[model samples]
Each structure stands twice: as C-alpha cells, then as structure tokens.
Target: MQVSEFHLTAYSTALFSTWIFIEELGLLFDAGDGLSAGLLQKARKVKYVFVSHADRDHLAGLLQFQQLNGRADGPLIHYPADSGSFPALEAFSQRFDPHIRGEAWRGIRSGDALPIRDRITVDALRNDHITAPVEWAKSLSYRVWHKKWKLRREYLDLPGSEIKDLIAQRGRAAVSEEVATLMVGYSGDTPVEDYGRWDGAKLLIHEATFVRKEDQDRARNNRHSSLEEVLRMAAEIKIDQLVLSHFSSRYSAEEIDTTIRRYGREFRVTCPVYRLLPGQIHRDVLREEPVWSL
Candidate 1:
C-alpha cells in the first residue's frame, strides 16, 4: 500500500554483498551473502527472488538459499537471461544437493513483467551496470506494481446499487478498468543514468557505491553511482521516499550520514531519505529515522 508498509530488511556493501527483503510481497531482490542467516526462518516466505546481475556480490547466496528454501511450490528465481552465472549455480546446486528442485529457475530479460502475487507484478528492466549488446540482458532494475480495477470516470458518480447492477448486467469490464500504481522500485548495482524510471514511485531502493566522484569514475568497466549523483537524481525525479544502499566500505557511517544531510540540503530534496549503512543489516529500514528529510 505504501513504502513503509513493505517491511524492508536489507544489507549492502560495495563489492561485498547486497540484498533487500520485502516481507509483504515475499520478494527478495538480489541474494548476496548472509541472506539466509540474516532472515533465518523468514527466508521460507520468499516466493520470488530477482537477481540483478552476475556479480558475485549480488548473487553469492543463491546456493545456500536454494538449499534452505527450495521446494516445488517455489522461491521462484528470475535472473538476467544473458548472465551465465545463474545457470551455472543452478547446475552445481542441483548436483550437490540432489534434492532442491530446479524447476522454478527462470531466465528473464528487460521488459518482462512477471506476476508474483494476485494483481501484483515485478518488472525487470535492464540497467547499464554491465555492458553488452543491446539484446543482452546482463544487469537489471526492478519495479513492483499493484494493479486493481477501478470504476471508470463515467461511472464514478453512480450509486453502489446501480454500479452492482451495471456490473451484473454489462460485466465488470464495462464499468471498470485496471489502474496500476508503482509501489516499490529497486535499482540494482547501477550508476546514475535515468531518473525517470523511478519517477512517482512510492519507494525506491537504489545503489550508491561511492561517496566521491573520483572513485566512481575510476571504476569504468562495471559502473557504480556516487552519493552526490544519486542525490542529484533524487532531486530531479518524483519519488515519495528513497533508500540508498551499496555504499563503499571506505566511508565511515558518520561521513555517509553527514554527506547525505549536506547534499540533501544542497539539492533541496523533500522526500525522506533512508540508507543502508555499509556493514550493517538494516531491519525495518523505514521504521528507523531517515538521514535526511526536508
């Protein structure tokens, strides 16, 4: 319903680990190290796991997670179609464990919107984190949408009884149409590129792998975002609330928080900004006080 209601628990560190668990949707975005241990028994609730890329830091926990939670029903996993790592992992996992079902592993590409729950779908959109041919889907960003049928504008003034009668006579489609709301978005391991994808989202979990521009610029092969760049994008875009993750270990928590507060003021961003500190597992991230909101 709202970003805060997602019950998000996450942990992220640049080149080390990154994962986000949204309890309400039973969705885990990127299965990095320690995911199973961090969530414990709650990991069983994961109905969908979306891997962002082939980077080991982003998907190292898949084997252990599959071992612990795999079943016929699913913890259905979707990864970039072009990334060979997922298929390799699936092979080794099935061979080693021999019991974990490999049936639900799926290869996905950009623009694939797979349903995770009734009226809710997760869309995989390609990001520029890993470069390849235009057709290759190596890295991704994801969005969760909640779709529901609402009364058409023409039927908005009708009485409840009349609406029910109309529905019975003409069918629901005659008076109602589906409307979708962008509930949550996860920008998995990416540099700041387009701000429009996350516009009007209820919440966004984005990666900010560096605090300094020089460090960000140095990593030319596999791209990453600087804290300033992300904040700048946030200022330009329309988003309700933001959660920044995947900060480099080089920065102390104090420096990260201070920079956020400073840049937040510089950018004049109004939305509440939450963050996952480099080495900590942020539990109920929305419940904690944000680093900046003005």
Candidate 2:
C-alpha cells in the first residue's frame, strides 16, 4: 500500500501544507509558495480539499492551486462559515467561482464532521484559545478518523458523544466524522490552553514561534505558542510524535534543534521533535514505517 503523507510549506512565518492524504484521497489544507506549488500538483492527483483556516499564510496559494488544477467534480470547499473572519475566502469564492467551479462553500465549526472517504472522518475544532474576537475565531482546526483502525471500542463513537456533549452544554456545535487513517492536529494560531483539549493525536503538528524562554512574554502577548509551549503540549498529550514548526526567522536551525533537545530532555518523552524552517521540505517517512502500533 502506498503510504499517505503530509507536506509542509512557509507563508507569513507559519507552517502550511500542500496536501495531506487520508485514505486514498488528498485533502488540501493551506497552500503556500516555493515548494508548495510542486506539492499542490502532487495533491491534485487525489480527490478533495479542506481549508483549515482563513489566514493569508494558510490560504495564500489557494487561488493559484484552483487555477492550475482547473475544475473537476469533487468535494465542496470545507471552511469556517463565519464570513467576517474569512473575507478573503469569501472573495475568493466569488472571484474564482467561474473557473474552479465548486459547490457551496460549506461553513463548519467545532464538532462538525466532514467525510473525506469511506470510514475516514474530519472533526472540526474551534480555534478559540487565540484570544481573538469571536468573528475571527472561525479559524477551524480538525481531527481525522478511521473507525476500523481504532483499538478502543469506545473511541469509535467518541467524536459523536463529545460533539453532542459540547452542543448540549455550550448551545452551539459544528463537528463531523471523515475517514482518517491518521490523526494529525493543525493549530492555526492556537494558544496553550487549546492544547489540553487535543488528546490522542498520533502526530501533533503545531506552531512554535520563539526558541528561547526570554521570548515567552512576547509569544504570549502575540497569542502564539513558543517552542517550550509546543513541547509542553506534546508532553501533556503524550503524543507519539511531535512536529514543532512555524518558527521565527530569528533562530537558526542549530539553535532550534538545541532548544528542542534541551527542553525535550526535561520532559523525558521519546517522541521525536522536528522543526519546519523556511523553504524546508518534509516527506512523511513515518507513513512508510508505521512506527506507532496504536
């Protein structure tokens, strides 16, 4: 079986993906430039697209992606329905409606499930921990699923239970189930508290803007997670593998690695820590190896 993978790109000091494979189909998250275009072409071979957030770094190359791929019947563009926060997405929808033809852009929120393929599910999570306005909070994060692969019997229906609980208690809901062989978490500017809610992710793809503890104040003020914060989250969740990215240009590759190693030692966790530098290309070797048995 050909292993599915996740590709990363740089845009606005953040990490973006050209495409991610769930089941046999490809889901395009955020699009960037540089190596992103090449990855997007590779992703087009698969079937669907899912835009996680509306930030420029996340959606910069989306228009170009649509233009290059042209139009073919597939899933409707899945994104947050909040028009106020995602103005660019709304404009893109109107401007490119002719060439890249799509069904209505389905608005999603925390708890919504989007079926990507048979048994594969994508559950939307709110990006509220950012301290941004509610309108801007529409930036959706996701948790994918493959029911048959779940080891715990209760885990199969946990998403629905969680969503129902959230809605009944919170009075609002937007979660869905899409078939997913892997559970990857994308934090488009999420804060530390948000990390607590994300449990059992095999690979946690998160942002780490600063490398030093001195920058902790700045990271908090900016409402972004620092390298330490990312590591802390990884330790808290006990994730099998942690991919730390969205680094600040101030730190060199060596510096980032050193910082990660220093903090990683304290946590005593064996999960490998990886960084995403500008223009860096990361292939999913883990998919080929299948190290995590759970």
For all candidates in order, the CA lDDT equals 0.90, 0.58
lDDT of 1 by residue, 187-286 (tens): 9988888788998888989998888778877876758889999999999988899999999999999999999999999999889999999889988999
State the displacement of the C-alpha of residue 134, model 2, in Å, after optimal TM-score superposition: 5.7
For candidate 2, write residues 1-294 as lDDT tens digits: 222244433233554333333324466554544424556546555355566666555656555665555454753567776635455665766676665655345677777887876776777777753455765436666766655532234434666777577557755423333334446666655655655556767666677777776776755556567788777767766566666656777777778777787778776656766656534565543433321122
Model 1 segments beyond 4 Å from truth?
A: none
Predicted structure with the largest TM-score when compared to the true one: 1
Q: RMSD to the native, candidate 2? A: 8.6
> Worst lDDT window (10 residues) for model 2?
285-294
- Give residue 267's lDDT in candidate 1 (0 to 100): 96
